[model samples]
Target: MNASTTGLRRGLQTAAVGSAAAIALGFFSAGAANADTLVPLPDGSITETLVDGTVVTITRTGETANISPSMGSTPLHRNVWVSGSTKVEVSNGGSGTIQPGYIVACQLTLGGKSGTDGGMSTTWADPDGAAKQTAKTAGNLSIGPGQAVDYKILDLELADPFGAEQHRAANPYKGKGSVTWADSTLGVSGCAGYAQARSYVKVTVNTANVTGNVTLWGQPFSIG
Candidate 1:
């Protein structure tokens, strides 16, 4: 072959190889961008004494959060699937209702031992104007920046006294009861900042003489 022709052929081969390498790199990058993240969370438990000398123990076990890429393929959208179980034990033949759920927040910090955003408390009823409450039972949440909302995992449908169908977030129980949830969806949108979620179990116990409430908080984890 002529000198110029040989050089041209070699250059073409090099360009082809370079293009193939680039395509492979792009494919791997896309796969990594769309990959899911599995988070094994730490289990937590709490014990509280009621006003009537009744002891209550609440335990949260097998907690996990599977964070996924943005559902909308944008920074404003975050999706997560959470799984966990809550067990409650009451003393003195006390009965109670168990409420297990998650608290998802955007840009705002949760108030607690591990979370302290402007000294705000992360209780079930947020007296602070940070986040508005929602009736989203199945974990489809929508909130703006600096906002947080509660997500109940259970949606117990029952007939009311008037024969109308109603949904209850709490499950009534006797001495000992437990609830398990799997693959609960938590979809957040309309927030351009970082997002986080935490698990919570609130139990309202009633004895023959008095009634009280005990709450257990879980570790907070990032969604995006």
Candidate 2:
């Protein structure tokens, strides 16, 4: 695949200053030629250096990584609206074991209007426009031992019924949610050993005029 496409897949696969001062000084006197020349021994010489003269070094190493995904549910003012999108970020929190070739599947629960509920539906979509009514999975790219994958879900379409009862019933939009995704499934192909397989899925919800708080949860997995 192309670079853009590859990056997109990699992103969806996982389920996913200060300053100091210093000074240096030199002591020298120009007197008569007969005057004895005083030499300063290098007993850790004192020098007047500029504040920026000092150097600081930082080193990074290893292949282990961590992925984090966050989802938000916002109250829509309109009768018909979409749930707040979810943003997933990946971090290389030091080196750790991760599945080598695999994808991540995420699932979300779209709570419907409670109380005198009426017609309310929700739908989920991935970055690639793939629809996910429930939890969807994606992945199968190579993530350097210390690398990470991140992406967002922007398609959570919600349709709600217009009425005070419909809104009051769903007063406290409390629902159980889950996100399940895995890297590409690994297997032998032809004479080659294990290789990567590409797959992608989106997570979304279907609800409207949500009057309560929404929470999202995810399960963790590592690639071999």
Candidate 3:
């Protein structure tokens, strides 16, 4: 080959190898850095009878979790988008309110497990085999290892009669109540361990005889 043509061929070959190497590095970096997980959760249901013979049935369906890399870009941060619907049915012509939310935990077993001793720190079970929890909020939350927090799925804002802003976290219904949520953001920070989340629906019913609370819990899913 001529000297000029030989030099051009070598230059083109070097450029091709360099481009291939850069593409391979980018592919591996994306696989390690931006890997996302999508989980389809099973439906949850529970039925119980209140003190006044009021039959309450709570169900959660069409549940899913899309877990992605944290915005913080560290092991201590996690982000998730959840979607589900909560339905409540009260028998005997009763009226009630429905509160739908999620419980996020790090290194803790969620539903069907007994928790600590007393006060709001305790986790108890109802007659229908559903675990109960306290400590609910509508804002950002932080928890350590072996800790969990509850948050409302809705933050409906409205003005009171005195021209003040008020946040309503629950909805009221007569006999039946239903609520659906999509693309709800649930984030966790300062957790150095694996994280999980579950859905819960709490219903407070008022009948002619008594007032009671019934809660139903969904299956737990990982968020890493």
Candidate 4:
């Protein structure tokens, strides 16, 4: 409850940052790692601390919120890195097209980096009956250790995904879209290595139509 103590607590409460060494060990809530030398946290979970000038890290059992868990087969969303930053800006990107009972597929760009990097992802089946899945990313992104990138993966207009009956060739359920992510968030401030930062993207499509559902399972893309 002292002024100095209150300020330190507030600072640490913010997303932990920077590199360093600590003058004194600090009190952290339980579940805190024993110390820089204690039993390591399980893999996936992350723990970092900055005290005085010391930087401490402890690993643990957990999932990187952004990276999807590995699936039996290719996951519905998987991250792939591109040459550019992963931070992207998407507009309503102009209204997407939807006809009475047909799906117009998004054009695919094929070949080299442009081809390999840009394209509509394969349409995946909705595992559950309800169309709950869609492409998207977690809020504010973690670009690297102690670093974060900010960007909005603009939502595009599309029809909701439907059931098995709607997956017909003639009544094609589709729309067009383009994705771009840049590491523009990183800079000379606390975020270092401006040129090396990156961002990850998850694309989801689910929209509703009068007669049928239309949707594309999410696919994760990474930009550097």
Candidate 5:
């Protein structure tokens, strides 16, 4: 072969080798990326991430009474997530007695990324105006003393967005969130009396790029 032809052939061979090496390197890089990608939780896992624009509805079914003396306090516990915004609806079922000179109220707590005692808490109730006594009723029951009350507390909505610290450590893709509900006995002065209370809550979590597994932990109460 001529000198120039030989040089050209050698250059072509070098170019082909370089191109093959580049393609191989690309394949390797892609495989590595795929391997590092996070996977969804396995079947039967408690934690779940809703797809963007997807709504996950958890309906609590049944009649479970969390009974306590109208004069004493107790904590209601559950594990839930706060991602996008969530709407919660609580329905009360049954009758209870709120004796005179006693005060009872409902309270909710939202824990930080570390669960309860790790975040902030907020309370809701009717304000007492000029009257020295405030009376609250649910259904056919009267809240003031000398009477029995039957009532339901309806549609309570809460919106949780990103940037808000998580109440409990959440798996970016696979762990559970924590939530708790309880009734207060702060001012109930009457002797111990039983108050029948039943509630059902439904929560819908928003979706995001939270990667990895997550789990929800709390004292399991009745959900029916």
Candidate 6:
């Protein structure tokens, strides 16, 4: 083959390799994000809707994990979360609060134990005048020979004038828990959460004024 032809072939081969590398990089990046996936608990899980028309699912990972943010570092006794990497696309549940846009709230629990007593919750907010994230754990359980009582586990709470533009009173709590059931007292342990996972996450990029979507990655993330 001519020298020119040989050189052209080499150049094409190099280009092909570069494109392949790019594609491989894209796939790897996506995989890295899943390192933080929220595993289901020991025979426990819950699916609920946020006031903002977005659905949220919770599951507990039998293991424990550490979450470090600007506030501080916390070691979640048991791994449980709202599935941080899991994303979803949703329409506006309510009108924009500030107007010309919507909001998105993503939440993950550092530690969660459910269907029992006392658990952790954590909620991360994304919008104007918001904190990075917050978590809490709280619960109550009572049993008696004559009667038994099961205090309700706190679900997501909404603020007055609830909606997409509104605020969440509680959600995404975090912490560890165990059952100390005896003939007498049932030891209940934990705190409570208060923030907001409005199901509103800002699209990494957008031109529209109204924040119709509330997501972390801008587009739909983990629905499947």
What's the lDDT for all of these models? 0.82, 0.21, 0.77, 0.25, 0.27, 0.28
TM-scores, one per candidate: 0.79, 0.16, 0.74, 0.18, 0.20, 0.21
Better of 4 and 5 by TM-score: 5
- After superposing candidate 1, which stretches have Cα over 4 Å from the reference? 1-28, 108-131, 135-137
* Candidate 4: stretches off by over 4 Å: 1-147, 153-174, 180-185, 191-196, 207-224
The best candidate in terms of TM-score: 1
The stretch of ten residues in a row with the least summed lDDT in candidate 6 is 97-106
Cα lDDT tens digits, model 1, 1-224, are 89999999999999999999999999889868797899999999999887778999999999999999865888889999899998999999999899998877777524322233432245434423323566454767777666677788889999999999999999999999999999988888887678888888989899999989888888889898
- The residue-by-residue lDDT of candidate 2 on 1-224, one tens digit each, is 89999888767664220111111111222112223222111111111222333211111112122221111111111011011212221122111111111122222213422211211112222222221112222212222211122222222334557532321101111122222222212211111111111222221222231111112222222211
For residue 124, model 3's alpha carbon misses the true position, in angstroms, by 7.9
Model 1 lDDT vs. the true structure?
0.82
Which one is best on lDDT? 1
Evaluate model 3: give its TM-score: 0.74
Better of 1 and 6 by lDDT: 1
Question: Residue 147 lDDT in model 4?
Answer: 23
Which residue pairs overlap in candidate 1's backbone?
none
Writing each residue's lDDT as its tens digit, candidate 6 over 1-224 gives 99999999999999999999999999888656543333231223334445444443333223211211211112211122222222222233222211111111222234533221221112223233332222222222211111112221223345455454433322221121121111111122121221121222222212223223333311212211
Q: Can you write out model 4's per-residue Cα lDDT over 7-98, one digit (the tens) per residue?
A: 99988865354222221233332225422211111222112222222222211222111222122112121222222211111122212222
Question: For candidate 3, lDDT tens digit of each residue in 171-210?
Answer: 9899998999997888788777787777888888999998
Residue 34 of model 2, lDDT score? 21
RMSD of each: 5.2, 32.0, 6.7, 23.6, 25.1, 22.2
